[model samples]
Target: MSDHVEEQEMEAEALEAIFDVSFSVVHDAQPFVWSVRLVPVDCGGDESEELEHNHVAVKLVATIPPTYPEDCGPELDVEIERGLAEQHREEILGVARDEADANEGMPAIFAVCEAVRGWLADNNEKGLEDVSMHAQMMRKKKDEERSKAKQEQKFESQKKAEEMTEAELEEIAVRKRRADGTPCTEENFLAWKEQFDKEMEEEAAREVAEREREGGSNKKKGAATEIKSRRDAEREGRPTGYELFSGKAGTMNLEALEAAAEEAEEGSDEDDAVTVEDLDVDENLFDDDDDLDDLDFDDDDCDEEEPEI
Candidate 1:
């Protein structure tokens, strides 16, 4: 208990000493709260008459922690006296935190106060500099948000694209129409017409490409089939009779085969030799003299048959 008391008393003394250094100190003895007014910032006591009656200065306050500058870093807070943007409030808090960090293991209230005072002093002799700084910061934040939104939207669109099949996408593109129920104006008509024309042109181009691809594929398949057919015929190593006579085997030695065929036609396959006379016809083979001899022989046979029996 004594040690805790001693530590509190020492921290109180340090806070008092910091308050003595050209600052306005608000004392609340029960809780040991110190509202150290950092000077030279527009935290509100200057007399510039062009200001609105509702304006007041920004304020910084620190709650004296028993373990400050020893066991823990300073936790600074800002008090906005009137309407203030989140940007400036955050900036002031950041500056105080930075000062606190720089003066570690030492009482940093005065240092933090001074750092804020210097920033306010450099930025403005009058109180209105926070307005421009606040606007710029807010604009920067908005621009970042917008850029992030666009990137997210593009990512989502890409995902949707990847999910759709090529045929599905093409079908959707062709069939999509304006869904708004408002009566179409001339401007809407023209825009729709332009869009329709573009879609048609793209579709035509795609069709042409598809046709070319199909044509190339068919041509290659036909060539492959023709080559395979020729391969099958070669593997068989046999020629049809038509192929033989059609001069398809002109590259082979067929003179002896031709001679064998001629002999077979002449009924003289015992040898390949043949003569025109061997194939000639005898004109007297069916003559009348042979028919008269055949009739006389028949009459002699008829007379001899009766006596011999």
Candidate 2:
């Protein structure tokens, strides 16, 4: 008896489980249930008042679960939700209706839920693979962009270097100026050379003229010195022409010599006259015209005939 009672409770639990599951499905289909009823009717000549056919009626006064998973199957939940909003059409509405009808029973709802769960799991795995592939593609594109930027920078640098090289070569090839900072044109160079030669020549001529002037002044000075020395000697009563001419040999006879001595003495009073000591005359001499005229006088004989000898 306890076993039978336990069996009856189990069966009641099973029936209640099925009813609850069906009610949940109906609720998912719409918003509200105004009434829910199971009516019984007798069928096939069973006149027993207790046995009848039963029909369950559920009246939806308001929509429950106001929206569907956009369209059909849980596997396509992401696609349906996105696709249905873009294309609000009869096809997507029909898909929602079919999903609701198919899940009206407890067994069907359970089977469909299991299949949808598996599909969602598979979709998540595929989404992970797609995400990985997209990340790899982004990395490759970034590397390629970096490589291109570097290549462009190098090309620009090379172009600038080449331009600089060209400018430097042009500068080197062109002639500029001389070391003295003068322009190296032919006309200018020749003009400077001529001017330099002219200046040098003028300088040489001036030097030569200075030397000649110095030499002439020295010669004039020497001549003036000689003349001054001669004049000094004359003033000092050094030998003069008159002194040499009026020696002792100049004396005649006594009277004539006396007269001559007197004339000499008188003449010596003047600065230009001969002196007595300078007169080369004889101390003793006859006053005869014949003797004076016959005197064979050589300069040496006159010197020998001097009275002092």
The model with the greatest lDDT is: 1
Per-residue lDDT of candidate 2, residues 131-159 (tens digit): 35675587467669879999999999999
Q: Where is model 1 poorest over a 10-residue stretch in terms of lDDT?
A: 300-309
Predict model 1's lDDT versus the native. Answer: 0.63
Model 1 pairs in collision: 43-57, 43-58, 44-57
What are the per-residue Cα lDDT tens digits for candidate 1 across 35-138?
Answer: 66544433244345414332334578776555655766656798754444566678888999998899987767767878876765543323333568776687
Task: List the candidate 2 regions with Cα displacement exceeding 4 Å.
Answer: 1-180, 238-309
lDDT of 2: 0.44
Best by TM-score: 1
**Model 2: number of clashes?**
19
TM-score of 2: 0.20
